[model samples]
Target chain A: MDAASAAIVAKPASVDGLLDLASRDMAGVDALIRDRMQSEVPVIPALAEHLIGGSAKRLRPLLTIAAARLAGAKDDACLRLAASVEFIHTATLLHDDVVDSSELRRGKVAAHLIWGAPASVLVGDFLFARSFELMVEAGSMQALEILARASRVIAEGEVMQLTRSHDLNLPQDLYLEIIGAKTAELFAAAAEAGAVSAGATPEQQKNLRRFGKNLGLAFQLVDDALDYSGEAGTLGKNAGDDFREGKATLPLLLAIARTGPSEKAFWDRAVARREQEEGDFEKARRLIAETGAETATLELAARYADDAKAALAAFSSSNSWRPAMEELADFAVQRKM
Target chain B: MDAASAAIVAKPASVDGLLDLASRDMAGVDALIRDRMQSEVPVIPALAEHLIGGSAKRLRPLLTIAAARLAGAKDDACLRLAASVEFIHTATLLHDDVVDSSELRRGKVAAHLIWGAPASVLVGDFLFARSFELMVEAGSMQALEILARASRVIAEGEVMQLTRSHDLNLPQDLYLEIIGAKTAELFAAAAEAGAVSAGATPEQQKNLRRFGKNLGLAFQLVDDALDYSGEAGTLGKNAGDDFREGKATLPLLLAIARTGPSEKAFWDRAVARREQEEGDFEKARRLIAETGAETATLELAARYADDAKAALAAFSSSNSWRPAMEELADFAVQRKM
Candidate 1:
């Protein structure tokens, strides 16, 4: 656990290489996920099936399984930990949909839209409590505390975002804190718990945490950028969602900073009122591009990805896990998703 | 610890004696709760305060603290566990308000109606995750596991209630299972965790679990009856809430059993449609009274309360905790709340 403060990662590494390296373990995590997600109450399994069964997010679980690989683990606690991480992610998505009033998720209708907000909220809770049970079964109090704290931080972040919505003057640091807590906290905890489950040295655990945190930051940055990219095409999610929801993402913030009075009025009317005139989305996209906001977003994402890879410097480069994770960091920024 | 499986509570005991017995410990639990519920996210605490701060039951925490007393705990883990139990209960209440579209709670406007459903739902998540942190901090894996499992069961029970909604012919035992899981599970877990934190023997923990479970069942049965009690006047919660919500509570279910064709048709319209005409509640009240539904409901509650008291017999009649708890069981059905 001593690596708690390390912050270094390498050049862009292949995301596919990362997945291929742990394909077998990834399969196990999925199987465990499918089994654990079932419930005797039919609505439970039906609803859970719709949400979890829809996504193929092998990323968070892959990070967990890969972290264990780096730690030379022979036990399967990593599998349970990985599944728990996915469950946490899925649970948050359910609740997030309810909070954001999102109509779509992963290109499919949001669970809340189909099942109603009540089911989505309660089922999310069911998944969360079930996640804790898995944490306990993994037999690591440290892991449990880390994940539990992360979960709390995630909720706080969501609340922060909610409270900060549509405020064009939203500070950069506060925005970062919101995303860090809302997204990166889970990523960081997943990597840390994987290390803990594998009995990694404190230093190694700290390194993994840093790696996960930076990678997560890079990924979220890309997501925010993609929201304005128009052709984002990630998870089949439509772009301009942040705008429509009156969320003050980085693109809008960056572009707004450089806009004239007329443009500023444009953003204020479009975002503040959450009222998009026809072609407003297209005009917003053009403004964001003219300001080079997407490039800036991607540039920062790349830097964070580098930090994520560099965090693994203490590990042997000869160790496939390190290089694979570095590539995964690269994918965090480069992929459409 | 010898109280495990012991069955020998006397006649229904006085509920106030139990509350009086734990008065000092309840104060400590309340203090801990106030400290823990605060959050840097002002809305987190603001929304939370509106829900938990407005009214006080202090009953759930009381059971936890009192159970620890039964096992002679010397440490403060019981206080943390008690606080955690209360947080979980409060979180559920927040979510329940959103689910039921409840306009009021604790005789006041529901948080959802004031803060909005998004804030209420997200804050509920924050409280739940914070609760797990508390469980971990209590330093008893046994307590953590028991509470986590209980939390999951509560979610399942809620989902069951939702799925079973509008089914006038819902099975009696199935209804029991629903209430048992939704309400009794947490109470049982709280008492069991208390014993575990006290380092009680497995036998003692089992006994306490049984005691808490039966007491919870009694408590819930009374709540179901009180929904039709007309002047429940406890906690300032509105009566006919269940009837209006079309929830198939015990009184409604029992009363329906005695109704003829016309009465059955009336119930079918009111409950299934969840659309109450003027004077419908009055008619429903009359029917329940004529059928002795309230009496039957109280009788069942008393039976469970007796079971709750009997579960504490092994603690020795001389032990004041046992007597108080026995009396507490009696209070389950007797209280206006």
Candidate 2:
């Protein structure tokens, strides 16, 4: 097998071993998600059927279900909470495509490209409203509070990221802060809601939430790294797309910080002007490699993965949730796409 | 004085009477609305300073406060609820300009034109999220549920309108339904929430809400009529802008329904196509007048105003809110801009 295929095969074996431990417990949650994702609006149902019924990793919902199971109170409430997280995640994706002006998502023409921007935006609003309605039905004030705050943070992070575009001076701390608000907060909320639904002890819920947050951070860092290194076809997008858009992701940010003034000028002209040609992309890759930015970024992602695994140590080692939680940590750093 | 000036002078005398009735009771509610509209974000503060701090009529908030007072409540909660309603209304305007690609509003460059679409959309989301946060702080689940559902319906109505663009055959029932969801529901919610917040009896709240709903219907129909008849400079927009956009407002819908075969082809080529030259505009206007569509629309709007006034019979004449409620019903039918 080719190196990429070999790597993919190795990772799933680890995931399989983890899933075997808790497969039965997750079945009902999965079914609930499939049911609630359906919509009554004709266009909505068609769009959703194509998008949600396709191959989604369902990572966020999995975290919620696992967290609930670990809390030791399996019930229908957990299923509803899990569905809420997935809906919010889906809603954000719909809006994000509009913000990014993306033409394709998940190998399909984006909804905005097909239906029009106004329709896509309103549909995204519909999903957001629907998600809130579902959360309210969950009937926990604390859950409502958590989800609302997370949604606001996500929006704020997006605005901050927009303002920071092409600014090579962005610090690693700022990068972490942005990702924490935009991505990790939702992940953390998903786990917390699951624990809350299942009546987990406060301390246990906090620990599980921390685990999800760290895992999410690591997941995003790895995603940014892969933008520079992954194959375009496999990623289902052009390689270096972030660089083309002048988004200063981890590898680019670190490289700018470490590189000399002369190399920095090249990046400033290319990315800040959003004028990267064929040769400029190669130079960016080489500069990132020469400055050890790629390696440093990967190391940071690995550290986060390790931290995530350690956070789960508060639970019993023999618990069924233990293995799935570990695979999540591993997946954070090792996934190809 | 000329006949029109005499009528204008006479109208303000009635307005003065309404203001005298509600002035003392409304001071605290007005002050609360002014305070909570402030924002900490630089863009938010700048935009709000220009938009909300301007001389807005504050009609919606006044209806909310007046409805609460009519229900015999004098609590701070009503003020906060009124502020929340206004915030949601303003947020929609910010986003709507971007959706419509409008260059001007209220005789100035629109917020999106001034700040860019991305900023407009994000700021709009911030305001929306902040409004929900405010409602949550109000600590009323019932209020949150009502406002949340209203928001969803408004968004759905927007999408429905987008889909129906330039369709001259749009049914009058569908047109009213769309406006009711998009415009009237919020008015009803504003009134209902005021009463709900102040612990009004259920029957009183229901009557006041119905009053607001009917009043809102009249208000929108008059606004649509003014699009064809109002002065361009005074209205802060071009006359016949709705006709140019092929919006099936009540008048246009009525005109299309009544058009004979001879003029139907003209509407199909000009109005339905939304491609109007100077001659086409004049011809279309003449045709609509000849069909008596304009008069029919005015009659329908007046009927709603009558229904709105009838709803106030439940409250005693001595109630402090009675005069302002009556003026609001009259204003709904008579406003020129």
Q: Give candidate 2's TM-score.
A: 0.89
Best by lDDT: 1
User: Which CAPRI category fits model 1?
Assistant: high
- Give each model a TM-score: 0.95, 0.89
DockQ by candidate, in order = 0.81, 0.48
Query: Which stretch of 10 consecutive residues in model 1 chain B shows the poorest summed lDDT?
Result: B1-10
Model 2, runs deviating above 4 Å = A1-41, A236-238, B1-41, B279-290
Encode model 1's per-residue lDDT on B1-337: one tens digit a residue: 1121122233434557877877878777778777877888999988887777847676777889889998888888898999999999989999998999887687778899988999999999999998999998898888999999999999999999988977888888999999999999999999999999999989999999999999999999988887787473565677888899999988898888888676877998899886689999888988988898888888888889889878898887887888788778877777776
Q: For residues A112-148, could you state the per-residue lDDT of candidate 1 as single tens digits? A: 8888999999999999988988888888899999899
lDDT of 2 by residue, A1-337 (tens): 5322344467552555545644764566567656654544456655655556666667787788788888886566776677778777877777777777776666567777888766666666666666666777777767777777777777677667767766888877888988887788888988888888888888988888898899889888988888888776676556677877889899998888788687766887898887667788888888888888887887788788778888888889888778678877777677777
Candidate 1 lDDT at A127 equals 92
